[model samples]
Target chain A: MSEVPNLDIIIKGCSKNDRESQKQLYKLYYSYAMSICLRYSRNYDDAVEVLNDAFMKVFSNIDKYDTARPFKAWLRVILINASIDHYKKNLKHNKNQELSETQGMTSDFRPDNEIRYEDLMRLVQKLSPVYRAVFNLYVIDGYKHKEIAEMLNINVSTSKANLTKAKANLRKMLKVYEDAAI
Target chain B: MQPYKDDIDQLFQEGLSSGNIPFDESAWIKMEKRLDAADTIAFAYWKLIYPLAVILVIVLAIWLWPGTSDNAESAPPVVTENIETHNNTDANPSSANNESSTTPEIGAKEKESYKQAPEEEDNAETDTTTLTESLGPSKISAENTDEPDVVRATVSENEATENSPSFTGGGEEYQSRFGGDLKILEGLDWMALDGYRGGEVEMTEVPMDTTREEVIKKSKLLFGLTVSNDWSAVGVSEFTNSGPSIGAIVEYLVLKRISVLAGASIGSRKYSAVGEEYWRPRWMDRSPGNEINTIAANCRVVDIPVNIYYHFAPKGLNQFSIGSGISSYLMLREDYAYTYNFADPNLPDTWVWENRNKHYFGVYNLSVVYRRQLSDKLYLGVEPYFKIPLTEIGIGEVDLYSFGTTVSLKFKK
Candidate 1:
């Protein structure tokens, strides 16, 4: 990881169209952007794709950047657009149906032990792209359901429904582990 | 009880830290390589093509168009006003009789002042007393049609010379013929001049001038009407996704090329989905009977945009403009968001509302506009501008930006 500069310095460098500056900027915000991507993505791959696209736009338009703003805030907007673009392109082909059915879903549980973070992550990864995205955005990334709905072109109700469902599913997964321990 | 929800957050945070995220090494490498090998040469080459072609075409056409400087110097101007009047009166035999028999006699001074054009001289002495009586009402228009290009009517005591009655003014014969105004009409050159001083100046009927420039300018103003279109992206700050937009414009000119623009494009910032699919409950499947459960309740204004703009453009055809100005915007809908939860699939699909702490503020814009001048006072223009936020429109550290195009019309002052 590179040492991140103050937002002023990054914006000044971006205005100069400096490549290293752009790369540095990307590194600083890549995690946040990627987190957002994962939420909207079907898998890690799709999230990464959205992240890359968002970075590309940031680079091309860096000269148009203003220095008075927080860098992460600006980066978030780009990531969101890129994610929306990615979603629009890949939405039809997504196999969301498989992840929608809650019936007969099996959960892995740890007996007589505290649950591992890694194991939780594995379960998150196992979630359908749509569910994972909503869960991450609402719970982890702190995005509002309305925003998610607009970005995803769905109704506000859908976003709310998904958040509730995502949380419930996660709770269920965690319940299995508790039951196993018992 | 297992602390499922509490542990899940930590688990996800851990997952985020690990090397779980995928990277496209080759794609990034190729993209970087392409960026490194910039195509400056291709761009440079294309730049020269337009100017050269324009210069060549202009030069060749000027060479072929007939030069008329010498002929213009010697050619007699076609008489306009005075000649037209003389010809009108001469063509009517009834007018000739009226001139001879009018009851009202001309004043001696007036009779001596009127002079007939050379063409009308034969009937000059035919008791012009009657013509003098008819002069008051017809004089206003008569100046436009009178025949003689220039007639010097000097009242001379030369007796009613051809044995015909002549209106005498102060013991002199009066002549009534004169031609066009040389000095006034001389300035009506090939350029776009102001309204009529010599001929008709009515807006309802523009005079017939068939030159290319005149036709183009007139048509531009005649069809002049304004039109404007703009769109704004919501929930985006540094990088905004322009959302659905609304705007209004008006075009008013002879050529219909000039326009006045006032519109607001919703440009908060751009955004992306976490992926092709956002998060959702595993139980809500939207098939035959489960349709209600498939309903999606959206999040709140985590990021929303409100944009306002005012633009001006001159003349141009499609995708072109000839003038430039500013595109001002005000960002209203910040990144605040609300959420709605849905009922379980086993139950019916119902919505539950929730709100989040999202905020937005600040303003940003692009000032470049593409202007095309289609006429003297008309234009069509487009601005494919981008807005980069100076600060987060919201309280978060998320960056915001947006890209979009706007069309405008410019009018002559």
Candidate 2:
């Protein structure tokens, strides 16, 4: 039952719809959960929306939590699912550039490894909702493309295409940022 | 420090991994309101679940309780009575049942019955008196007297545990003097309906054995539909690919503690490869150039799985089992889309290999399955499994090892 520190009482309270305890629980993992939401969100406002939605789920389903597992893993899954839900509303624009067209674009695209974390997050935020979602799911969250496709209600090739384009766009943005840095 | 320019997955994985978001009090306030609203709605709706659950529990209890089979059972057999029975006139034994009177053997049996009648008369009278007491005056007259109204008291008219006993014991004849109306098994201990009079006895007990066997056999065989997601990792490739599989599964319990399971499903084995590790089939016109490319190989396959499971707990509401199996993957259709570096495309730009075979041998699999019996004939199950590939498959011809979980709803025969 290794939970986040001081979570036993707060989780119980949250399950009981205790306001103060819910607040404490939310604040406890606010930044941690928001970091994930941000990578998948378009901006700060969107990130907050996803974070709040994920928290709502956590509080609503608090009683179902198994204390034997790590709490973060459970919370992470909920956050990812919530992010996917938010992304689905934006999935109508599900178009991607042809894979062949993605060629010749990476020439001399030496990555600026010294790029700051905040800048990288901004660069990720610049991707379209579907691309950012696919990138976040496949790269950071380590979901397979098949899982991403199911979550996003799309095909496997679409997930792969989105991930490839996401990385390409990120590199292109990194290049512009690197030239600006010089 | 230099890095592989194309492989940026790790870069973002590391960059975005720093956890924690600044606490937003406004967001919490907004969520609190939503939670309060949700709580009210949930309370209003969830109250009905209690009553529903209670009703379901009552139904389940009655359904599963032992010996309370059906009203058709538990209900007493109907016997028609009140026909005036004729007086015992002709003691023609051959006209009564399946015996011939002219035969010396039957004559000897009748003489034996006449002898035993005097000795067993006291017990016979007492048992008959009980049947006579259940209704109007008895129709049977062992002393050959008046025609009594037919008594509706029927013995062995309902199903009993099947018992086949000797027709005669101690040389005492079971044949009644009047013959068929009161044919009795003199040595059968299952029932001693010593004084059933003027009632036609039907052999209803024999059918119960087949009925019981049918129920047992039906429960032993289970049929189910299954859906699963498996991730296959080709040899020496860091990438793990996933595909959805839908199938039908059949399980037959061969023993109390073991069962055999088999399934046939169509599944996709697709992956995103981003390195030089490429296995080309004979279909491609060109070979690999000196550049990293992306090959999104999409494959549809038929997987046949055969396995044996040993149950840890078989007869219960919940069952746990460990199983090991072999799966054969047959590639049906495969299409690979290759996007290579733009620079090096002059020298053939493609590669090919021969020895293309559609049939892939079995991949060994092991799984732990948990099933909860939802009803007498239905079960819900989840099985987590791992498959180690002994055969190379797909257009890439890679040893595609996979691990996944399958969810199933099974119905027992």
Candidate 3:
């Protein structure tokens, strides 16, 4: 219980940029916060970058420690926000490449058209960056479509539409695999 | 909502399949050092006060408990006095009558009555013996005037005969022992009988039914199987969709409702949901690393159940059990699949690749079981069992090795 109070004191000491205190704070949350960052990053090295960047923010804003909420929970929010910022920067850069719009067959889809589980996963992984992000946030992360639109700076309908396309593409790939296996 | 089912399920599972990324070894060591440097006074106080409080309470209780005993000392004297008075009164009744003239004390009414009964019996016995001797010559009545009515007649004749001394005093002076006059108390002899009495023991025997009519029972287990649209159970829903699974159970009939059964069960569950990704400038190789990619789902779980054809139901078989207990299946192991997808088939074999498997044992359950008899040898059962794995897998050190529920049918002979 008192670890929280001690953590506050430690943060205060780090804000002074005391070399030992700074090292102590860095070492305390580096591994765990980095793991969280890794879950949201492109690779291991990006996770470490996000971790270092989030900790610098934590040190600068040590005065905001409320002494009420858990230190870990607060640290998690900061790390998540940092990872999001990093993701958006990459998203903007990738959008520079012109994408050729492909037309769908525009037919009602049947779910029972047997599909192998493996091929479906490959097709999902093949989705464009924006669609995959929207699909993951909305479907896997349990975020509402509205939250997805707000987070990605896109309209709710766009998020919904992308998810539908992602599923459709996966189903088509799965159908081909299931047929070949038969 | 339409089950919210999507390809994202597949992606999540694929990501988990990538395998547990081991923690950086240096990170744990640094964490320990940081914690050690932090001082925690409140924790120290709590540790000190708890044991101190417990010791004080124990000391207070021992000091305050009652310490002395007065009743144990006063008992023996009362018993000694009662024995001495009881013996003297029985031995000298006439001497006691003369001593009363000297002491002028006849104590209690009951004690005086007890003394009078023994003296009266002695007097009566002497008179009867004299009458029998004198009456022997009474037939010569007229000649009996010499046998005066003031007759000490039989008494006087015996007195002359008793004046003759009998042979006395032979050998050694020995102290009397062995048959000494020790009085036995009431109820003292029952201790041996009490020692032999049996203590409480509950022995129950399940009797066999006279009628050999058979009764059948049944049971089942079911495991939900998940398949990533991506071919795994580890990552995002955008990546995985589970396949269909089906299960059922049955048992046979024996005496006293005991049944033996054999049944097989099968099912699958998907794990791994795809997650958001970021690029590390340091690790950027192919161009500026400017694209967002999904973390592929990694680990998934699938259950394949085995059938033990002659397994008897676990209950009621004990009613007429010839042996110790219920005989049932001893589960060997859950089947596992260590599957990997070549993210880049063209890459060399040694290229860094995402590793994951459906072989994780850490999901919700590991053991397969049958419920009680639904009919005869037929039983319905479910076990949400778990196994602590012997090896490590996935992003964590422990691989969730085997998991699933069983819906089975058991057949008996």
Give the fraction of reference interface contacts each candidate recovers: 0.14, 0.45, 0.06
Worst 10 residues of 1 chain A by lDDT: A100-109
Strongest candidate by DockQ: 2
Q: What residue runs in model 2 are displaced by over 4 Å at the alpha carbon?
A: A1-5, A61-70, A88-119, A143-158, A175-182, B1-7, B14-20, B43-82, B85-413
Q: List-wise, what DockQ does each model earn?
A: 0.15, 0.22, 0.06
**Candidate 2: lDDT of B379?**
66
lDDT of 1 by residue, A9-50 (tens): 776676676777766666666556666676566556666667
Model 1, span B4-57: residue lDDT tens = 446556566555545434344554565466556653432467455445544543
Per TM-score, what order, best first? 1, 2, 3
Residue B98 C-alpha lDDT in model 2: 17
- Give TM-score, chain B, model 1: 0.26
Model 3 agreement with the true structure over B1-413: per-residue lDDT tens digits: 12223444655545423433345646434433444454332145634543554454344333322121221121111000011111222343222210010111112222333345435556332110000100111100111122222211111111224453321110000001102222111110011111111111111221212321111011122122111111223322232443333333333333322333333233333233222221121111222323223332222223332222223222221111111111111122221211122222111111111222333222222243444332221223454333334333333223223333333322222
Q: Candidate 2's residue-wise lDDT over B1-413, tens digit each?
A: 33323558877777677644568788888888888888778766744643554465456445533234542132122222211122244333332221111111222233345344434534322111011111111112111112232222223211222363323111112322324243322211001112232122333222223443454345567887777887766653544678877778899878756889998877777666654556642212233334436666667778898999987633324667899988887777665545556432221122211222465455898999998655444567899998887766664656666778987767644
1 or 3, greater by DockQ: 1
Candidate 3 vs. true structure, TM-score: 0.26
Instruction: Identify the leading candidate in terms of lDDT.
Output: 2
Q: Compare candidates 1 and 3 on TM-score and give the better one.
A: 1
In model 3, how many backbone clashes occur? 127
